[model samples]
Target: MTHEHAFSLHVPDLVFGRGALAEVGEHARALGLTRVLLVTDRTLRPLAPVTRVETALRDAGIEVILHDFVAIEPTESAIDRAGAAGQIHGIDGFISVGGGSSIDTAKGANLLVSRGGRIADFLPPPLGAGRTLGGGPLLPHIACPTTFGTAAETTGIVAFALDHGRGKTTLTGAPLRPSLGLLDPTALLTLPPMVLAANAFDLLSHAIESETARPFESRPAPADPARRPVTQGANPFASLGCREAIRLVAGALGPALDDPTDIESREQLMRAGLLAGTVFGMSGNHLPHALSYPISTLAHRWTAPDYPDDHPFLPHGLSVALAAPAVFRHLERRLPDRFAPVARALATDSVADALIALMRRAGLPNGLTAIGLSDEHHPALVEGALAQRRLIDNAPLTPTAADLAAILADARRYWS
Candidate 1:
């Protein structure tokens, strides 16, 4: 494993297990939150877990104002609306109880309301105006992640939509990490098979990305140390988390999807996601996440049974997995010796074939075309990927526009 002279690790104060949702209220109270802004989405609002969170918040004497209209990805407009609500309610603390999107929405709102700026003004350069962040205390936020992946509850990154909601970029800083993370497997028992599979897909991607990320020793020190990214590189500390997460996810994904009501499988998958997220927090994700942005942004709007019609969109994990096979194969040649263990972990000589088999079992997208992209989308995909320099730079190898185009071309059909 690569070791660096200096590296920083950050994680939320974590509470895990079946009844972990019950602890969120007390956590908020302990943090001295009197007026709290609870951000969720229309889809999750009707669930029992959300109801329990609300009841607990109210019972704790915290005045909770619900912001339930957040987009599935928490678009710029949705964050604006959430921030407006927070400003109007005069909230001193924040709570997010849903998937990664909801947790990101809460972080977005906290950053906007406390710092007072347009979201673009605080984003990383080239994506935004490259405005410097303010040195001020952000409102304390408790992230209750009902979903099994994305690990937004522990990361310092928050994304916002751009280019007419056809692209995405992130705002990163240490203050953006949640003060606490509550992982409750009971909240995930009701997930449909497809959704459950998507969550596992993300966890799988996170593990591979963490294990194969650029070595921290090779990265140059940031010019501005205060605004560092959550991921550094694949260090010894991060490798342990990534390996354990991979083991847990490899064992749990199929079982959890097949038996949605199996709380034990869900708990294990949740733990895997948390472990993976913690690793990426200190040692970032690379190409899979970077390449997914445009494919997700420009894909045909498809609706899932459990999701809202207005919220119709491809899940991020599906988009990320669309190119997984191609990515693993491409990287195997680039870092043959380093990736041998990752390939072995999946019980195969070829990481690409292993990833393809796992994704097929989970029933994820077969390729870029399966997600509604086509030959016509290649240029656009490269363009979108190029704009994501933050994620792109974290890779052990940087892809030229032509390199990205080739990957997208190869991703046109995974099983072909």
Candidate 2:
């Protein structure tokens, strides 16, 4: 029997491939951005690629202001500081030059610059402070992704951390998407081995979660177009992206992680990340993201949280990877049929087992206990997952607290 599906997907003008960085100047000129904020971190500064990006833009006569202090897991303060810098520099456009963290920070800055208010104030909650964004006149934006995850280059979503918050929240709307996306595989060649692995894991999680999440069904009619949210239904085009994304991640992560210098692997990972981002962007994610929060927050003990969300302390991708096997098993029980595509995508006998093995091979922690979550943490984690209405609403089987508890128990066992 044939299934029917309807959809709408929005992607910025995209320039992807080798030597694509050279097109930056032309793309910027096309966007008519004279003053651009080059949002990036200090680590990328020594690379010729960073210089190349600026030079290309400069040769095109675009005035560039560099925000070099972008932290690993950006904070509310960082977003504020970046927004203030954009205002002071009179930046007319934004060009993000690093991974998910840098791109998300740039997106947050744009929201403030275009809409008006502290990034925290505009947040709706879980992370948003509930105050509306007041930045005016959205500016032209471009993303030059150097990492293989988040796909912030093309999406309208910007994940951000709130002061003293438990997890990440996002700024969503069409205006948040960049006008252009520049994905050059060459830029990703320099990623550290750990980061490369973590990012690959992130892409895998996106594909799995988006593919296996509950099927979309009709809900109460929206009050109006403005109030309508994307999650209320699923789009077919996004599902295609999800399938391709899974295939790419499974095929690419191992080679890329083991051989960071392998340019081909890096390029594949980048494309996989973009495809995964596209899928998750439209279909939205569910359980793994929710389960990842507490685990991510815990990761701050090992490294600073520099990404948009607070729990991003673990790197959004890594945290998601750590939680995937368990999440998928739970999901498979809820919707056995959904796993068919995931199994096919991963070329495994079964989706859950495929993901479990993939996670192991990727060096992702096998279970919560392996990563340091104790039994004491399970209850709070369950509560946190419960509070994630956005993700929970998308779950194939709406898990109760007991269900979450059982999954955590499984995770504990898997770790040992």
- Expressed as tens digits, the lDDT of each residue in 350-381 for candidate 2 is 67677667666756666666666789988988
* Residue 68 shift from truth in candidate 2, angstroms: 1.5
Q: Runs in model 2 with CA error above 4 Å?
A: 1-6, 125-129, 132-137, 221-228, 303-312, 413-416
How well is each residue in 333-390 modelled by candidate 1, as lDDT tens digits?
8889878877667667887887788888887768877767789988988888887777
Residue 44 error for model 1, in Å?
A: 0.8
lDDT, residue 193, candidate 2 = 64
Please give the distance, in angstroms, between residue 381's alpha carbon in candidate 2 and its true position after superposition. Answer: 0.9
Show pairs that collide, candidate 1: 231-284
TM-score, cand. 1 vs. native? 0.95
For each candidate, what is the lDDT?
0.82, 0.75
